[model samples]
Target: MQFVFLLHEDEAYFEAMGDEEQKAVIAEHFAFVAALQAKNAFSSGAPLAPAMTGKLVSVSGVEDGPYADSKEQVGGFYMIECADMGEALDWARQCPTAKYGRVEVRPVPDYGG
Candidate 1:
């Protein structure tokens, strides 16, 4: 099974970090990803820019940025192929982001065409 882990962080919380502290936080996750890849437990992952860079595209509605002004925003994601949800969640638990915000583990839909 494949799972997509959504790493959410409080934008303000992250921004509040000192430059060195923030770099350390990012580096922690980078090391984790590399380790998982070496163990063949990681598929792929990447950090997302702040939500302020996002656009709300509504067909006939307003398209806007800075989305909701919420404290929490999705900061990144990882797609992992695992034997089961249990295994995937174990990896999620190791994420450094968990210390700061929430990690949403969602199963990717399988659309066989």
Candidate 2:
């Protein structure tokens, strides 16, 4: 089975951190990836650019930015192979983003594509 860990955080809060603090946070993410690789669970993951750089498309047509009302934005994601939801949850708990933000763990379904 595979799961995706969606990392959500307050972009403003992260941007407010000092340079060293930001670097530390980035380092933590690297460490997390290393840990996942060690367990042969890592598939793929990457941080998204600022929300402002994204666009939203709906029935109303395309719109500028993600435009969410909440302060939290999706900061990154990690796709990992695991035995089951239980194992996926364990990995999510260990994610560094959980310390400063929230991690949403969702199982990936096979669509035969």
Candidate 3:
């Protein structure tokens, strides 16, 4: 099974961090990724730019950004292959983002082509 971990966090919280704190947070993420790779679970992952930098496209028109009505925004994501939902949840629980933010684990369904 495949799962996607959506990392949500307050942009202001990260922006307010000192340089050292930010670096430490990044280091933690690196270690987490390394652990996933060692278990052959990591597929791909990346951090997203600020929400304001993203565009929102709809049937009406393209907007300036994905302005969600919430304090926290999706900061990054990780795609991993796991044995089952239980295994996926286990990995999500270990995500560094869970310390200060949230990790939403969603399964990716496959349809026969």
Candidate 4:
């Protein structure tokens, strides 16, 4: 099975980190991902730009986020192919973002059957 891990960083937590601390945190994540790649447990992932750079185009006039009340936005994600959900979650738990952010591990559905 494949899993999508959406990492979300708390706004307050992020703001609390100094510039160097923030960079260290991001470096930790990069190191963690590199380790996963070395072990062949990582497939792909990338961090998203700040919410200020995000566009809110909803069906309804629900322009939120940068507009207002946007907390804990998704900062990044990892897509990994695994033997089962257990393995996938194990990988997610090792994510550096798991320290201050939530790592949402959800299996990707297949409709090509």
Candidate 5:
């Protein structure tokens, strides 16, 4: 099974961190990825820019940022192949974002066409 971990964090909380503290947070992610790679569970992952840089497009027009204001925004994502939800949950539990944020674990469906 494949799962995508949506990392959500409070933008303000991260921005409040000192330069060194922010760097350490990023380093934690690197270490987490390394652990996943060692287990061959890491498929791909990358952090997203701040939500302020995002845009919402519709048939009528485009809106700035998210449709609604929210403190928790998706900060990044990680794709992993695992044996089952049990194992995937374990990995999610180890995500660094869990310290000051949330990690939403969602399964990827296999489509046949």
Candidate 6:
């Protein structure tokens, strides 16, 4: 099975970190990726730019910034192959983002079948 982990965090939470602290936080993500790769579980992952840079498009018109009003915004995601939902949950628990944010684990549906 494959799962996508959506990392969500309040932008302000990261901005409040000191320069070194910010670097450390980013380092944690790098380490997590390395760990996933070591287990041959990593598929693809990346951090996103600030939410302010995001754009939303609807049938009516295109708009600037996120369309949803939520305290936490998606900051990144990781897609990984796991044996089952239990395995995916294990990885999600180990995700660095869980420290200061949320890591939502959702399985990818196979529409081809």
Q: Largest lDDT belongs to which candidate?
A: 3
Q: Extract clashing residue pairs from model 5.
A: none
lDDT of every predicted structure (CA atoms): 0.86, 0.94, 0.95, 0.81, 0.94, 0.92
Q: Return the top candidate by TM-score.
A: 3
* Stretches of model 3 off by over 4 angstroms after superposition: none
Kindly list the per-residue Cα lDDT of model 5 for residues 24-64, writing each as its tens digit.
99999999999999999999999999888999998999988
Better of 5 and 6 by TM-score: 5
Candidate 2 C-alpha error for residue 45, in Å: 0.2
Check candidate 3 and list the clashing pairs: none
lDDT per residue as tens, model 4, 1-113? 67899987766687788999989988998898888788777878998876677778877755545655557878778888788999887887888888877899999998898
Identify the runs in model 5 with alpha carbons over 4 angstroms from their true place.
Answer: none
Tens-place lDDT digits, model 6, residues 6-102? 9998988999989999999989999999999999999999999988898887899888986559978999999999999999999999999999889
The lDDT, on a scale of 0 to 1, for candidate 3 is 0.95
Where is the poorest 10-residue window by lDDT in model 3? Answer: 62-71
lDDT (10s digit) by residue, model 1, range 20-44:
9999998999888987888787888
* TM, every model: 0.90, 0.95, 0.96, 0.82, 0.95, 0.94
* Model 2: per-residue Cα lDDT over 29-97, one tens digit each: 999999999999999999999899999998999988869798899999999999999999999989989
lDDT preference between candidates 3 and 4, better one: 3
lDDT-better candidate, 1 vs 4: 1
Please state the error at residue 2 of candidate 2 in Å: 0.9
- Report how far off residue 47 is in candidate 2 (Å): 0.3
- Full-model lDDT, candidate 6: 0.92
Worst 10 residues of 2 by lDDT: 62-71
